[model samples]
Target: MTDDIRVLVIDDDFRVAGLHRDAVASVPGFTPLEAVHTLDAARQALRAHQPDLLLVDAYLPDGDGIRFVADTERDAFVLSAATDAVTVRRAINAGALAYLAKPFDAVALVDRLRRYARMRNLLGGDAALTQERIDRALSIMAGGAEPATVSRSATEQLILDGLGDDDEASAAEVAERVGISRATAQRHLAALATRGQVEVRLRYGTTGRPEHRYVRVGKR
Candidate 1:
């Protein structure tokens, strides 16, 4: 086990992967090995790099992120736009040290990574478990005591700003564009969908089923 934690990011979106790579690199005592777009590439990178941490996307073009965790014996985290309870539980079962719904703030991500680093350092043959330490770790990874403070008005503006030239976008796409967590983006999008401000549709792909996609309503 290396003292300097190495990270590998697995995400299909080049931009999102880049953002995460930068986020990890900006943290002290952490180094990013590489960011890959598919599970196959991720596995190959793991074989070659033997990374200390894996930041995996929930959905990938080649396979599910859970499969990667099952196949690898390394510490991992699930970074995804899907925050459904089922997905969260699956990630936990898959042995992820943490589950971060995208688009997580840079600071928030750094905080989680720092906690992981601390945990790794503190682990020893006789390290005793204490409630305080456990609580602190959980709090750090779960965004601490601060509730998500993004305003509905700000969310609407973010959605609008993320609109593409084609006038439509998926919830995940918009979340990435707006730099807010996917869960937050979906909440705002749900409100817009209900009010006829945006249209919601199923996005079918190779990820096993169709996912909800949101677009500005009445766009030409």
Candidate 2:
């Protein structure tokens, strides 16, 4: 599994930032480091943590976020309620990878984050890169991208879809969800773990054999 993209949530509203952090954790390839409410704290966090992504808001109690986004070198995405054309243009001009309006769906945000991860993987993971592959990855980030589909059996896809939240699941739980026998589900999940699409860890009991829990591949 790839390293989870560490995220810093910068928003004035504590509740909103907490929600965003939870949303980030629910995504496969993202993990929230911390949430800060003011520009000073954000700057201190940026220096201390050096996160891979910044989910920033346009309004801050200490300072405006427009200049901050424009000047920051890290990858930034704007999630703000400010829907004015000027704010939108400024966010784009400030090099935001994605500008999600307020009240957006968490699923939609996860999709975009997956796209961003795909692009980064294409550029950083591939040893032999090509123009076509680069274009395809960039297209994904540009929102005209194809779905990140894989060739697998229908049952396998169903299991993968069921793990979208990327939470750890036991074989019995997966069997219930996929309408399969526990043995079959465990077999499939173990195979996926071998293929690096899932991760398996043992949970010890007080007085029995350890139980295996599986999670979708990511930094957990």
Candidate 3:
């Protein structure tokens, strides 16, 4: 892995900031910087560290954290107890990569961090972006709602069933196993992957080309 993605957490609550910092450090690819309790301190840390990402709360002692994200124009995601529509809209318009409501479980925060890591993994090159690549990155950033919140079709369920635990197979292989066309298999796999129900790994062969292989990840 390359240098860990450095993170700065900003919140007015000292305990919450510490919790968030610890959580960020627990993730595989992330390194949490010292957490800041005010937008003023956050600004100083930003200048000093220029971290790859920021985890910001909506309210800060000095100013609005979402506004701070906008002012910094850095890669930021919001974790706040603020549930107002206007605040959400501000986050959306401010270009927050993702947002999580406060009082969330550790698993939920871990899921978001992992999803962000996956997006960075996918779009990690300087080459020109293709539509497919852009779409895949966007899907990942969307951080699909949990399975219980998303209704799945019968075919999608069948596709999920085709991949056994510890199995990683290409869409074409899954198509063959599920008696579906490769295109259909690819489409459904992409959807499942976006929803965090499956993980995508790139298999490089002797030909030097990479093939995407999917592994079951989330619940049924």
TM-scores of all models?
A: 0.58, 0.64, 0.66
Off by over 4 Å in 3: 145-220
lDDT of 3 at 81: 95
Q: Residue-pair clashes per candidate, as listed?
A: 3, 0, 0
Whole-model lDDT per candidate: 0.75, 0.77, 0.79
lDDT of 1: 0.75
Which candidate number maximizes lDDT? Answer: 3
Q: Decide which is better by lDDT, 1 or 2.
A: 2
Any idea what lDDT model 2 has? 0.77
lDDT of 3 by residue, 146-210 (tens): 22322347557667756763368899767644444589789999998898989999988999689
User: In candidate 3, how many clashes are counted?
Assistant: 0
Using TM-score as the measure, what is the rank order of every candidate, best first? 3, 2, 1
RMSD of each: 17.3, 8.5, 10.9
Model 3, TM vs. native: 0.66
